[model samples]
Target chain A: MTPASLDLRPLFPAIVVAVTGLAVLLAQAFTPKGGRAPAAALSLAGLAGALVAVVVIAGGRGRGAVLATSVAADDFALFFQALILAIGIVAVLLSTSYLRETATDRGEYYALVLFAIVGMLGLVSALELVAVFVALEIMSVAVYALAGLQRDRPESQEAALKYFITGSFSSAFFLYGVALLYGLTGRTSLALIAQGLRAGGIAPAAAAAGVASAGAATALALVATALLLVGFGFKVASVPFHMWAPDAYEGAPTTVTALMAAGVKAAAFGAFLRVFLQALPSLAAHWQPAVAVLAIVTMIIGNLGALAQSNLKRMLAYSSVAHAGYLMTALVAAPGLGTEAILFYLVTYAAVNLGGFGAFAALTRSGREPVTLSDMAGLSERRPLLAAALTVFLVSLTGVPVSGGFVGKFYLFSAAVRAGYAHLAIIGMLMSVVSAYYYLRVVVAMYMEPPVGEDPWSRVGTGAALALTISTTVVLVLGVYPGPLMAWARAAAGSLR
Target chain B: MALFQAILCYVFGALALGAALVMVAQRNPTYSAFALIVTLVSLSAVFGLFGAPFIAALQIIVYAGAIMVLFLFVLMLLNVRTEVRAPGEGRVFKLVAIGLGALLVGEIGSVLVAARPALAGGFDASARQVARLLFDARYLYVFEATSILILASLVGAIALAKRDPSS
Candidate 1:
């Protein structure tokens, strides 16, 4: 665990991303206009390589910290690395046609995507607070720019501004929390901090014997925990901190929104699980109730907000907030099952949400995006195959039987109930039911409502279609045969505990 | 020596506070920028008094030097000819903001008072010691990651600010 014996093997995936991002940037700078295809291909190759590295490393290693104990290259980190890499690849595929059509097929676009994945990988693996903050900024800054990529759009600019301001504000709170934690425990490493807390309850035994009062140290730790919660809650887009999600999701390009919902949320949850379950286990009595309340509020607000949205993007944004709530419920559950539930739900959610956004990206025309519910009215008649795919995604999101979302939610709620939170689980079930109304509304609009005008569907490219097919297949396969993925999740959960 | 250091700390602290107030109250963007620079410089002096010479140097070099220049450049780029004062709208906002600010200040003050008996005298670390700590294995990863963060921000700025010829 010493710094001098740091192993770089666990960092292979992040290195792949960083190197590819730089290469993409250089290629973009040198390449002629309209030659951005190679950049996309290069980015995809890099992500695929990183995914392979994750699988290989996962097979070869035991669970432990690496890079001088700054990062844990455990099954948890490997799982998130694989998930984020898959998300990046899918997002890149989905972005290809959108970029070409919008005349923004610059190499920098792919570079930013690769770089953001690097951040997410680092974030999931980060074992220290400073590392966590650094990785988070690496992701957030890139994403802020990605959100405002379309410089001509006022909404895009506004989304970037709001996201950046709120994101940085939350980061400040997180850093202050880290400072306070260090003050209390005299350690920056989460493991050491936990040991410090367990040894003397709050402050180190030696420090407690000195001038520092245990009460003040405990109070500082509580404040730090609250600040950390606010920072992370904002990242996962829970209620009260979710005002940016709708606008940011609605304004960004569909592919970027897909990455934000699938990749960013998963990465944040990975960190959330580690910091809470592993580092702050002693303070569960203090944090568990606060998290439960947050989960209930997030679910209610997110679903209710979605109910009022006519814009497909806005609705999905709210749905993302609700999904975060569902994941939070899993976190509030008993430790082992809760961890397993989160991993399983995140995988299914990545598939369902990406597929959902991919369908929208597929329908995007040359000069206009498919924003309104009316845009999907005659989708069934125009592009029946896409409409069918959207139906599967929507159905899965609604937690209907024979879909991945249903199984995921079932496990999440059952785990919560087993943890003796039946009331919270009941509220979760009701919210899921409420969520189905909006999800089904989309299906109903596509299949039942008549066309308002001529077909506005653009030609779906091979890349977009390929991404859709993969995500759809994942959702369906996981739904039907959940055994393998659940086993993987369980194994990953074991490493953390 | 301790008395002199204490006096220096109070002087810099007061100067920093006054500069901050001036920065906030100033209507003209250029004047506000100048006031901010003064505040940063004075804060650096306070840091020096606290025996964190490296941080003080960084505060002056990074915050007062590079960041303030960037701020002034942005203000000039935006070129607000006149300060637009919304009389009624700002009043409520200002009041609420001040109320929150006071509450935060009060909380911090109470916490400091509660921990006053436990407060230990500061031990100064030289710049070399600070460097060693930062470059050590425990922080090396984060330090390296910060470089990548800065790199990402640099790339992002260029990507956003650059105009697309196709557009």
Candidate 2:
């Protein structure tokens, strides 16, 4: 708690992004009417600078327990920070042309994106519960606004309202969980809470709530764990808590939906892993069954829901929910290859979802977004390359061979099986098979069916083309050779305190 | 004295819950805002009974005082009318909401029974100690982070609420 320990280096990544956000706001303000500021480019450069900051300070002093353990810059943190920054880069790239096409290109769009990245970086690195909550709020509030950026659209407004209300409820659940844990252990730091829980020393809590006995402590811990799970479940769009996701995803601008599916989910899973693995490892026996049940229902319900959707965005939203199920299975097998699998799966998932949404965005013609399967008919004959890109992403979502999703699911299910949750692996595999039916339906539409009308697809813009290339390259590279990323994931899993 | 404190806690807790329910059910935006104030004040009183007078005062000063003023100002600025209420969502959605509400009630019930509020002698939650924690301790990082959260929300609110120039 010494003043000397209050170093700012560990926070450079977030600060750099925040400052860039302000710069974006200024750039927007100074631009002449009818002229666009380089808001998207500014966001990309800021993310690049933050990426460099994450690398330069990776092993620096005061990184392990920055600001006396409110946050940490450990390997686990650096890994997610780099991944989140990369996701931000692609999101900005995708938004450049997509936003302009939809006439939603505003400076606040980039600024809010940069701020959300700041939140994601902090969420992954925070060691204390309060810091995590604050970071989560920063991310969610920005995204809620982004969801409704097209003010002229009623659907967009509805999306924003639904997301904000449901998001606030989830945040309350999380805050209550934090309060319960602090009451049970008289601590906020994850490591100290684990220590207190392990020692069976329920410290004298603050004035509001306290546990008087061991039994009471255990009850409180279980309830807190459930509440935390619900909070994260809502964020990741798990089944039963995913009611708002389809509407929000379908209503928002497609590029923003891409960021929601990719960046927001990645940030949630990162904190979800840290909290469960770091603070509640000792209570594994009590919470593991709950997570297992959630994974099962999420996978079953998510894939089935997606099977019923013809709209591309709603289908992807449900598919994202199903992927959350697969990721939670890794949580069931804590502190081992399961941890590594999640980190690795998150990367591939982000790349694929961004690529999928990017391709979906390219369907804009005359400012109208064509989103149905019928609209995608004979896409291979029209925009052959775009159709091919969407095909690969869909194949990846289906867990087909020579795709990143295949490898990621392999590791996830294998880890689940290894942890004696063979039922989880079995259900996961069955669900992936079920998912193929809906995912490939898009492919069949693109390749086999005929276009419904004479309307042609929009040309792929430069920014979107670059983002697609990056995502496609990453997906293919991970599919063919995932050794480097796997090693990084292993090191990160090892560094969890 | 302990009996009196427990009774007061229940009363305030019930008031908070009832007011929250009323806020949700209110069709008028202005009436909903008033109900929210009732809930916030009841919760503040409950906090006072728990010996956390600092937080109790903060609940009133920040939420009931400053934030409520902003809410009312926005309502007035919008010059909103009380629209006719539409029927609820589909039957399934309504059923799900009711089920979730019951579950939430059960959660709160169990939490209340399992973890009771008692005055701990060791902790100092007075304004001075709270300030030191926010200013000088690990919480300094958290306190600073909230500014970023607030700034992001400010920008977000403007983005969402502003009228289009062309319109």
Candidate 3:
């Protein structure tokens, strides 16, 4: 239990981010009212330290488990840790201006965001089910409260309630699945469970007599995967389980929505891919088709749903759902090109999503977000830089050429096609085509339509501007020259054992 | 001693089943809470008969004591009078659920009886074992990390719930 016995260098990134969260709370509590607490700057510094740690430990130290195998620090975890931290940094930057403008600039926002990032960092690395469950809860609870950060607004409260209630139900389903897996395999560690399931026997250290027979284990594994899918499905906001996302996204603060759209989905997908591939690959013949079916329905339904939304946030919510479908398609082809595609696509998706929402959060719209497409009407004539950035994001979302979204979609669909899931790729391509209409409508409104009012648009703030710039640059760089990142993604994706 | 333990197990098991049925069938919320408590206490007794005193104590302390008290207090405080029922809440599904529940109970009972010998051979479930694992195992890190989660949640709850005069 002593620090000397454990090689904790790999866990340093999560520790840095988590400690900074507490520090943010401390600074917030001690600071005098009406005085700046430097919460944003402190979190950014911590995130930078974490990012550097991820790079420094990218070698031999991060390739194994620590803390008695409750969690891992493998290349896969490091890759996602880096991505999650990067997303946090950009999110914090965006939130600085977003909170100040909305008059909800409480210091807890940064601390909560940092905590959520810590959860995500733990989530991708966790090797044990209890750790996964706790990390998931940590991430979920923070976001649940964050969904209601604007306490004065009834919609935010409703969003929080809906999200929390649904989240708890999903967690119950997940825990039940975990219990079943433990009962059947008599192990709690994911790798051990997979070993037990594959060997068709109780794991060596367990009391084998209490465990079910091999035939029964398969049956229980099927049910467990179904239940686990329900849990992960809700988190990723896939179809039939995604009724809450539109409302929550529409009601929550725009920057938080950005993180929800980008970071949460990425983290959940990381866990989903790992759990399925690592712990339940033996059941893939059954689960793969289930995931494929979910992907097909999610892609079709999500695009169709987004077509009906007029509000900017709700549309992105549905679009994120559709993107979840696209990502799930990669799961069907995993342990190979599919894994690489997912790694590449998540970054592109995160960048474009953050860029799109960051552009919206850039301007103070009278203490609230501008909701309708017309809110961006003639935005090229007003904030030209923002208008251009938004256009790029929208274009990227539409998967057009010369954008990150285009390259990501190409890589993902090609991988799906190569993996004999050509049908999924075809359906995904068609839905993405269908998505072009709504996405471009916003772009058209921004560029072609007349201004809505005589009042001048507010200038974009510095922090938000920086956030948007970084996101947009990531999107563009990945679009044009994705060589370096592609190699990194290849290395990370191949490391899963 | 074996005969006595077996008899005790059967008595508490039967009592638990009877109390549970009463809890579900009772119309009054207050009576239902009492019945639930009876069921939980009996269940705890059953656990104690099964040589799991820690779990038995936890069952009584957590579910029967603390949670039931809160349930009763909330029911009394709210002063609820109406029957807690949804109008036309699908009886067919309820019947199906009850039937499936019984089936599951039978299956689990059979499995437990069959696996009693294997389970009896497992390592000690003593408090010392749990404490050692909590500290000696890496679960200590998980325990520590969970605090941050709790603290963050507490902060969030306060931030969202508290009234601000400035606003």
Question: What docking tier does model 2 reach?
Answer: medium
Top candidate on TM-score is 3
TM-score for each of the candidates: 0.92, 0.87, 0.93
Better of 1 and 2 by TM-score: 1
**Candidate 1 interface RMSD (Å):** 3.2
lDDT of each residue in A123-206, candidate 2, tens digit only: 999989999999999999999999999988898999999999999999999999999898888888999999988878477553
By the DockQ metric, which is better: model 1 or model 3? Answer: 3
> Over the stretch A447-474, how does candidate 3's per-residue lDDT look in tens digits?
8999888744568888888888998899
Off by over 4 Å in 2: A59-65, A206-210, B1-60, B68-126
- What's model 2's TM-score? 0.87
lDDT scores for all predictions? 0.86, 0.89, 0.86
On the 0 to 100 scale, the lDDT of residue A487 in model 3 is 92
Runs with alpha carbons beyond 4 Å of true place in candidate 1: A1-4, A33-37, A62-65, A201-212, A450-452, B1-39, B42-46, B74-84, B89-124
Error of 2 at A412 (Å): 0.6
lDDT of 2 at A147: 93
Better of 1 and 2 by lDDT: 2
